[model samples]
Target: MVDSTLPLFDEMPPAGQVAAFKAAFDAWLAEQRGSGSLRQDGSVAVYEDMWEAFAAWCLSQSPVVTLSSLDLADLQAFQSARFGRKSSDLSLTPRYALRLMRLIDRVLRHHASRTEAVANPAAADWIAANPEIRYADAAHADPLPEYLSVSEARQLIAFLSSARPRPGKSRDAQAPLTWQEVRNRASVGLQLGAGLTPGDVRALTLDSPVSQGSRVRERPWKLQVPGNGNSPARETPVAPWAAELLQHWLVVRTEAGIAGTFLFPSTRTGKQWQKPSQYECAKRVLEEAGADSREGGSFRLRHTFALRQLRRGTSPQQVAGWLGIEPSKMKRYERVLPGVIEVV
Candidate 1:
């Protein structure tokens, strides 16, 4: 018993559909405001502005965009248009991008909950499918610091120590103990053994690794980490194991004709290596030593260094000085210490 004059919602005109969506959106916002779900602040204005931009973009698309028609691809395209397509060209950082995506997801989920006909395309499963979005979500999440266990550290050190130097003209770049391998070994060793940050590693000069005359080979090496705007200059002792690797690198670096003041320099120019290259070098070493390389980068190694020192009865203040960070920041590490429970 279909009425001949009944209105077809599915075949509604693009303009009408957009108007309907706007009306539904306004109603949702009002309900959220009334329920105190949305605070009376600048955040509400930001949400409104983002929605306006999204709606305008939807209207501009061919065949028109309806609330029900929105999908992951459409959301991704909107993100690409608002932010830049490439990571380098991105106007917003990962955290901000994550906030934007979350806003859209929330609004859509609210709309879907009220309308049985509509489905939320930005569900957790769908969002997890996009690596960029997933990474952004993770970047915004609160998590424990990534570090190595005592056993893992021992295994990594053993591997680095056993890796023999292959010094010859016909040596493969991929082989162990080549110029690059020795350099990477020393770089990672600084992070694990001396608690050097990636920036600290880059800032080191040829004379940075100071050793006492005559006892240079017998005693532990001292490193001079230069200060920047954030931290002050500090001298820290390097572990004997790591110092040995660094000494080996000095010889290889000279023989390989890497002429520069910088300790870890680009092979061709002997100038400071780019940040990405430095990170990759550390990551490669971690992978070779069978350590986790997915998160934390060199910072994990630094964390491992901090935890190791703390476990050995080193005071937080002293460790903080070595790390070039405030002592209060060490509280996080203290809370994670084995057999220690934070009251607060």
Candidate 2:
């Protein structure tokens, strides 16, 4: 629904107030596309989609829907209606609801400014009705992010690079095959170095020439990592250390008589790795590397990757786009950024 290409008011009669405002909203979003504030990641589309969904919902509820006509009751209805929407599975998370409301807030504010209206009474009413509409602080939340220090990450990566089941632990079900250790190292490197999830790593195809032919002894560079779900793929710069480790494993992966579509395949057979098997491998790797005790499963690496970015002064907006994290989820990492908190 929202037509980004159409004019807000051109060729419209003066009586078309609601259509004018809706057009203005879409036009504003179109302009936002060029701004650094708007993410190039698919999230921009998702944001648009939320607004469109709200618009469609409003149309269903009332024939003449306008920003000024909307009140606190209407907004509440929209929030409650998510329970009935098939996309959200009837369980609209608080965080999702907040972003939708925020975008509603943003659009009304912009609409007022564009129209030179005295004030946005509807926006005011919604704000007053829900004072706690924003995301919570991650710094003080339960289950704080588990991150490894730079040195600790290095230690873990080192262990993973050489990790294989000891002869004594051969009976253990969690032990990775010796050759599979190499694959695990490469897979973990993406998470530790570039913030990719296991799914993101599993989604990678090794048949490409860059992956199949890149040399560690030669020029090292970045690669585009595909994202899962609505998240867009991002180009991740490969650090020499991570590149060396990944490339080493690639060679070993090839030599092990494993040839499959995936970058990391099952050790039992060179085929796609199922989700459960992926988790088992991750648990085994973390246990061996002393990172098994982290509260969040596998997600900690993603958190660590995000934390590292914030620590190094990367903008939260850019980092969010790079990591495919939603607006609410980024708050957890925002409070930990430098200058926001004290370090003892």
Reference-based lDDT, each prediction: 0.72, 0.64
Give the CA lDDT, 0 to 100, for residue 261 in model 2: 69
Q: Using lDDT as the measure, which candidate wins?
A: 1
Tens-place lDDT per residue, model 1, 98-143, is 6666666676777777776555654342343333455665643434
Q: How well is each residue in 265-307 modelled by candidate 2, as lDDT tens digits? A: 8754668875556655676677788776424556667778787
After superposition on all C-alphas, the RMSD of every candidate to the true structure, in Å, is: 13.0, 17.8
Model 1 CA lDDT for position 3: 97
RMSD of 2: 17.8
- Screening candidate 2 with a backbone cut-off below 3 angstroms (N, C-alpha, C), the clashing residue pairs are none
What TM-score does model 1 achieve against the real structure?
Answer: 0.58
